[model samples]
Structures are given as C-alpha cells and as structure tokens.
Target: MDISEIAITAAMASGFIAIHLMVRRLNFLDATPRSGWLSFAGGVAVSYVFLHVLPDIALHQREFADGMGVGAKEAESIIYSLTLAGLAVFYGLERAVKMSRGESRKAGEGDKMGNRVLYLHLVTYGTLNALIGYLLLHREDAGAWSLGLYFVALGLHFFTADFGMRQDHPEAYDRLGRWVISAAVLGGWVLGLVVDLSPVLVGCLFAFLAGGIILNVLKEELPEERQSYFMPFVVGVLLYAGLILAERHWV
Candidate 1:
C-alpha cells in the first residue's frame, strides 16, 4: 500500500475505535431485537449498493461496451444481461448447496459453534459478494446495478459486525469484536485507497448503520406493548434516503 493507503487505514482505525466506544448501553441490550436487526440489515444493504458499486459503475459507463460495439439499447441489454448472468448463476449454485445440505442429517445436536458457523457461512458469502462487486468494478462496465450491489456489500459488513457484537459481547460490549470492528474502520479505508475506489459511500454507510445510538425516550416512544415494530425500518430507509438525497441534491 502507498502513503494514501496508510493514511486511510489510520483514519479508519481511529473511526473504528471511536464507534466501539459508543456502544455503551449493550449491557441493557437484547440480541433478539428483531426489528432493530432487520432495520440494520436493510440499511446495510443500501449501504452496499450505494458506496462501492455506484462510483465504479459511473466510471464504467465511460469505459468498454460489451464485446460487441452496439447502440444504446444493445448496450443496456448487454449490461443487464451480464449483470443477471452472474447473480443468476450464483443464486443457482447457492440453492443447490443449500438443498444438498438440507438433505444431509446432522449427526449431533447443534451447539453455539454450529450457530456461529452458520453466521460465518452467511457472512462469508456476503463478503464474497462484495469482492465480486469489487472485481466487477475492475473488469466489467457494470453501471447502476453494480452501484446498488456495492451498497449491499458494505451493508453486509455493517450487519455482520454489528450483529456479531450483539451476540458475542452481550454483557461486555467491548471485547475482541470491538478490536476487530475497529480494525475494519481503517482497514476498509486503506483497502479503498489500494483499490483506487472512493471511500465516501462506504464510510458514510459505516457511520450510519454502525454510526449512532438509539435513545428510546420513554416519553417519545409509543406504549411498550403497543410499540410498532416498523419504526426501525422506517427510520432506516428514511435515514439512508435522506442522506443520499441530501448529498446529491440538498447539499
């Protein structure tokens, strides 16, 4: 990595440390906050789409056309075709693997390790998805769709680490997960520089999903038993959309 990469890594590290220091109320946290997790997941998915993929796609629009030099219609079809081709094949392989595994019987009772393995498996697939998006940014002229997928990838990062920390550091929110996530801050920024990608979307996504704390003001919230679970999702989309819109238009 060059000096820029080093600087980015350092910046990310500082950010990670700062963020970890803020999960102060985890002692009162519950891992089964499904609404919060779902909201988190959606926000993360958006993050991946916008951050890594968008800029790459913008760059690509000016680059190579499909192997055949064709008109605008042909270009779009080719782009969508190529995009769906990879995702389709991947989805198919994934289904096949899941089917095979589903058919296999477990020899022993599942334990924490089994659960963690499942999480790791899902996270690993997500990481690969991001990497593939990164590679597409390099090789293909993927446009808006690539942008969308990139945000999805960055979102996956937020989802995994945040969700993992929920489970891993239940009583103690500052464990190795803290260190790991902290490392990812600078690490991600550094990698962005190394890959020659902009860090704007990724960093903001990180700031948003892993960004702040939720203060459920009893006076501000609906009745405890009557609280609508949809609040988190609404908050999530609104936050992201607002951010995107503002950055594009308002700002």
Candidate 2:
C-alpha cells in the first residue's frame, strides 16, 4: 500500500479499537449519552445505508448487468436476494445468541451448546469487523474527507457494538471481545491489502455490511430498555446524512 492507504488503514483501525475501549469507560451505551451519541450513531449508520451504500449497490448491480449482458430486472433481483440473505443470516445469528445467553443464565455453563453459540457470535462479529476494515481501505481511494466521515459513523457504530457485547456477556466480552474484535479490524486490513476482490464481490460485501449495520443499529435503538433520545437520533440522521449528501454533490 502507498503512504495514503497505509495512513488511512492505521487511522481507521486505531479509531475502531479506541472506540471499543473508550465505551467500556464512557458507558455510552447504557448511560444518558446513549440517547445522544448512541442514537446519533445509529441514525448515521442507517442514513449511510439508505443514502450512500444502497445507491452504490444499485449502480454497481446495473453496471454488472450491463457488462454481463443480463436483463436489468434479473440483476436487480439477484442484488436484492443477496441483500436479504445477508439480513436473514445476521438476524438468525442474533436470535441464537440471545437464546444461548438466556440458557447460560439458567443451566450453569448452559452446556456445550451455549459455549458454541457464544463462540459463533464472536467469530461472526470479528469477521464482520474485518470486512468493514477492508472496505474502509477501498473507500479511501475515493477521497480522504469521505473516508473520514465514514470512519466517524463506523467508529460510533462499533462503540455501540462494544457496549452491547459487554452488556450481553460482561465477563467474556471484557476478557476476549475487545482484543479479538479489535485485532480483527487490523487483520481485515491486511487481508484486503493482499486480496483484490472483483467489483461484484466488493458490492456483495457492501450489501452484506449494509444489512448488518441496519440490523445491529436497530437492535440497540428500538429496544425499550435503551431509553434512546429522539433529538439525538434526528441530529445524527441529519448530521451524517448532510455530510454524505454534501460529499455526493461536491466531492
């Protein structure tokens, strides 16, 4: 990688890791700031999907269809299919994790099945972080300012993730979650440096991540236990959305 690429990767990886550690101290997830920062993060992530990521998906899918001489409708269907698959997979994963957590509370070690469930959740979480890290590098080539904004939104989203994981499995998350998942971001950047994904594959990654972001952010925000603030959510939506909009128009 060139100097610019390396710098972007380092900054984003450090930022992602820093946020996870910061949340443990700041308690942004469970505290009053949850309404402001957490809600804003959730809104920013959602707006990123609707405003920027989804449109890119549509554009890429169209380009893929044209390049392959396929029907536009078929291409659209295929893209949506992958998107739904991504959503369903994460949804199922979260449900299984919740069930395992409940069982763990009930039957001691919750048996081997419960252990496996937590393992799967952490593995998936780490893998997703890596994917996002890789995509961050890809986005940097577009513009530094755009990448900076992306980092802000993603860093905040990861903050909420750290909080949720720590809340769900305090001991396990503290001992393993922070280090492992933080490393995953760096690992993903290295993998991205070596492996050059095709445009279609990159689009698939974006689609999968878009689904994951939507699911994870909403899971944190919509719960009555969260006590999220309306204005912060609105502020986040408008603030991040306006940044993305400005980039779309000017950059």
Candidate 3:
C-alpha cells in the first residue's frame, strides 16, 4: 500500500477503536422508542451488504472458479456455502449467549452470563473485527473513495453493534471487551501489512463478513422488543444505496 492508503487505513482503524470506546456515550441510541439513528445505521449497513458485498461475492465466485479451473456452478456452491457457514456459526453463537442469559435468570443469578459465554462472545466478535481490519488494507478496490464508503458504513455498524454488546454484557464489555475488539482491529491491519494471503481467501473472508453483517443487523432490527424505527431505516437504505449507485455511475 502507498502512503495515502496506509494513512487512510490507519485512520479507519482508529475510527473503529474510537467507536467502541465511545459508543456508550451516545445516550440517544438507548431511547425507549428505539432511536431512529441506530435503525438508520443498521439500514446503511444492510444496504452496503446488498449493494457492495453481495455483488463482490459474484465476482469472487468467478475468480475462484477461474483460478481453480472449476465450473461456475461449483464455484457458486463453494462460495455460497462459506456464506451459509458464516451465518450459521454466528446464529449459533447468538443463541448460546441468549440461552446462557436465560439460564442465569432461571438460577436467580440476575441475568448474568457465565465467563465461558462471555469469552465466546468476545472471541467471535473479536475475530469479526479483525477480519474487518484486515480488509481495510486488502479490499478488492482499494481506492480512497472505496475506503471512505467502507468506513462510513462500518463505523455506523460498530455504533449499533457496540450498543447491543453493552446491553448484553454491560460490565464485561465496558471493562474488557471494547479493548480486545479495538486491539483486534489494529492487529488485523498490522497482519495485512506483513502477511499477504491469496485473493481467493480474502474473497472467502468477505463472504463470511457479508453473512455476519446480515445476521447482525436483522437480529437487532427484527425483534419486537427493540421497537425499532422503520422510516429512518428505510431512509438510510435509500440514501446510502443512491450514493453508492451515483458513485459507480459518475466516479
């Protein structure tokens, strides 16, 4: 990467860390009616996945097929299978965390999660952050504009995600989780600087991220308990999608 790319990636890495460190202070997101801004962030994230990440999956499928001398159908199966695996893995983790919480409540432990469950959640999310950090340097299109778009989408995503994390494990997340995740981001970026992986592997990583993002956003929004705002979510989707399309068309 050139100096400009390095600088941008560093700034984005810092931004990710800052989001985690400071998300709790965004008190408006904790509104009872479900903050429109949080919902809006979710929408932007989902839109990015559909507009940018999913399409990139198709390209990766083609490349993987070509590289492996496999047929298109086989490549699609391979790539989509990874996506499914990503979704399934995170779903299982989520269920485990919720179940842990429920069990704690049943035991009259006041909704506290076990250390094992907490560690599992932290590890899973830390890996996710690390992959995101690695991608900061290794995106398919490494232009400054692409980096900016990515930072905006995922920055908002981190905002919403941190909110959820705090709600789930307030004490642990504030005390230790944020620092681990923040370090994971910088660690992944540093790894990217020194360790080059195959393009096919990077594509697979992105496919996993696509599935994770979809699951994460929907889980937060679809629950009746959340009382999330719908119009702001729609606005976020439309506005970010328009920006992406305009960028593609004009830039």
Best by lDDT: 3
Regions of model 1 farther than 4 Å from truth: 1-6, 13-30, 33-38, 47-71, 81-105, 111-157, 160-228
lDDT of 3 by residue, 117-203 (tens): 999999999999999999999986566677788889999999888898888888899899999999999999999899888888888
Query: Per-prediction TM-score, please?
Result: 0.46, 0.91, 0.97
lDDT, candidate 2, 151-227, per-residue tens: 88788888777777777777777777788898898888888788877777777777888788888888888888788
lDDT of every predicted structure (CA atoms) = 0.40, 0.78, 0.88
Q: After superposition, how far is residue 64 of candidate 3 from its true place, in Å?
A: 1.1
Worst 10 residues of 1 by lDDT: 211-220
Model 3 deviation from native, Cα RMSD in Å: 1.1
Residues 161-236 of candidate 1: C-alpha lDDT, one tens digit per residue: 4544444233333444444444444444445445754343332222222212111111112335423356665565
**Per-residue error (Å), model 2, residue 163:** 1.1
